[model samples]
Target: MNYKLIVVMLFLVMGALVEGKRLANLGHKLKQEAEKVGKEAGHILEGKVAQKAADVVFNAVLRKG
Candidate 1:
């Protein structure tokens, strides 16, 4: 019934919606990246180099993305 409480509740709801969308997009991107990495990793390299590349790429993507 109070004006201040109504405004605060509306702000909280709007924030939750925005944050939920960003989180959803991030989750979707991670899934797609994981699959892409898995497929690409299976090709065209030896043991240590392949392993190192995968580690480096995965870490970089996870960090930057």
Candidate 2:
């Protein structure tokens, strides 16, 4: 019974780790896309205010961790 419980716990931990990794990857992709869009928008707009707005979005999409 104890060995079975340990095995189950191990599986749970592994699953959690996999999910965390997937989420991290997703976040990275989101940031990359946001940056690309932000840059494109800034170029298209061609104004200080628009560039500032794009900068705001780019910074907001960045993760601190």
Q: Candidate 2: misplaced stretches above 4 Å?
A: 47-65
Assess candidate 1 and give its TM-score to the true structure: 0.61
Q: Candidate 1 lDDT, tens digit per residue, 1-65?
A: 99999999999999999999999999999999999888777663566687999999999999999
Put down candidate 2 lDDT per residue, 1-65, tens digits, no spaces.
69999999999999999999999999999999999999998877788777899898888889542
- Model 1: weakest 10-residue lDDT segment is 39-48
Q: Candidate 1 local accuracy as lDDT?
A: 0.92
The per-residue C-alpha lDDT of model 1 at residue 51 equals: 90
Q: What is the TM-score of each candidate against the true structure?
A: 0.61, 0.68
State how far residue 39 of model 2 sits from its true place (Å). 0.2
Give candidates' CA RMSD values in order: 15.3, 15.6
